[model samples]
Target: MAFDVSVIIPVYQRQELAVSALRSVLEQKGVTFEVIVVDDGSPDPFVLPADLADNDRIRLLRQPNAGAAAARNTGVRATSADWIAFLDSDDLWLPGKLAGQLAFARDGLLKGWPHLTAVMCGFTQIDLPSGSRRHRIPVESWNAAELAAGCWFGPGSTALIPRNAFEQAGLFDETLMRLEDLDWFMRVGLLGGGVATWPELAVTVRVGGRPSVKMLDDAVGRMRAKWLEGGRVDGDTRRNLAAYLALEQASARRHAGRWLGFLGCMTRSLLLRPRLRVPLRRWWTEDPAAAPQ
Candidate 1:
């Protein structure tokens, strides 16, 4: 039997968390979906529970540590489902997540919006150790400018994308260890279909385990180069993106306790776009310890 959705999970060195994520997918209601777990050659092998080990709906594939982007691409190639949903191994879907997204798609199709390529929903960010919910990311649609500014989709787990969107936008960039979602979403935003948002919390993202400052800066730099290549972005958008990336670099430096580097980045960012001076000043004045991790 054909499934309505294929859930792709890219896991690396997190067996227990992957199991928890898989259980969450299995608990989804009102949707016929299959789970594909692509293990990116984690040193510690993922050992499935006995019940799931024998389950036909769930399949696990192992590949030599190609990172999340390649693992997700592998899962896409392995699945036959028309709709694709991605869930990070450390994150989870709440009950009715799939059902709600399916309903949203059905309504759009009924209204003659056949070009709807992606649907995203709100999510709650939970503090890892305490498991306490930190905040809810409200679901909202984004235009090209909004997307270019920053990632608004919450997390990969909150999105339900059509197979065609992947075909059109292409897979996530394997080179990026971070902000790959932003890159992919920006491409999708450029496609003119516009992402649809459901305005309901459908996923819970565990906060912590964030990448280091150097990794983030390198990744954002790569993303900036990719976007600016071939004059893909106009002048105003390019400036905005530069300022945004500069601020991201500043944040990374601040997180790493590099006060001088942080101040330099902040100055460069404000110079790129003088309108950001007020916010940059405020940010510089605030205690770095109070900043979001």
Candidate 2:
């Protein structure tokens, strides 16, 4: 049977979270969709429950440990749906998420805008520790410069992209273990197709679980170099990107207890963009005492 949308979920050693994500997709209303779950060689293996195993709407594929980017690419290749939406194994789509995006597309939100090839909705980030939720609304429209300033798409999980756009933008960079979503979105922007936003929240993302700081730093550093070499962004956007990268490096250093390195990174970031507000705010809020003398 033909599907309106193909939901690609990449799972790696997160069986329980993946199962929950699959259930959320299965429960979506007003949209004919199929779920493609790619198990990226989870060490312990991923097993679908008996109920899901027999469901024709769900397709499970497995491959050696190739990271989330590869897994997503594999899932995309396995589907024939015209529209593609990605959901991280740990994230869940609220009811009507797919229907809402389809409505936006049918109502000319994308058709009226020549540059828009995708639509994404807002999302709520649930702080795992405190159970507090913060709603985030990404920009309704964005150009390359705006995207270079930051990852305005929020996350890969919130986006519903057309297959043409996906093909043009190419697959996510497999080398990037972190910030892969941002990298792919930046590429999409470079391809001259922007993303439109739906104001309502469509997904709930669980946050607060931390990964290795050094690894994050390396990934961001690689992303910075890649964009720089692409030369798609202007001087101001490049400066902003540099400032953002520096701030991320500083945060990583701070997390690693390297106070001096953190201070140095913060100083460099400020020098790059003296009026940069994010680093200054993070400096004061994260550790006022560690602020440079």
The C-alpha TM-scores of every prediction are: 0.87, 0.88
Compared with the true structure, what per-residue lDDT tens digits does model 1 show for residues 184-274? 8778777765567776767889877657788988888797778876578876567766777788888788878899999998888888878
Question: Model-by-model lDDT, in order?
Answer: 0.78, 0.78
What does candidate 2's lDDT look like per residue over 1-293, in tens digits?
99999999999888899999999889889989999999999998889998888999988999999888899999889888888999999999999888988788657543576444678787877879888766776665456655655565667888888887767888888998777776777677777767777777779898866656778878887877787766657677677677767777787788778899989988888887787465322211111222222
List CA RMSD, all candidates: 5.0, 5.7
- After superposition, the stretches of candidate 2 with alpha carbons farther than 4 Å from their true spots are 109-111, 229-232, 279-293
Error of 1 at 220 (Å): 2.2
In candidate 1, which residue ranges exceed 4 Å CA deviation? 112-116, 129-132, 271-293
Consecutive 10-residue window with the lowest summed lDDT within model 2? 282-291
- Residue pairs of candidate 2 with colliding backbone atoms: none
Candidate 1 displacement at residue 107 in angstroms: 1.1
Judging by TM-score against the true structure, name the best candidate.
2
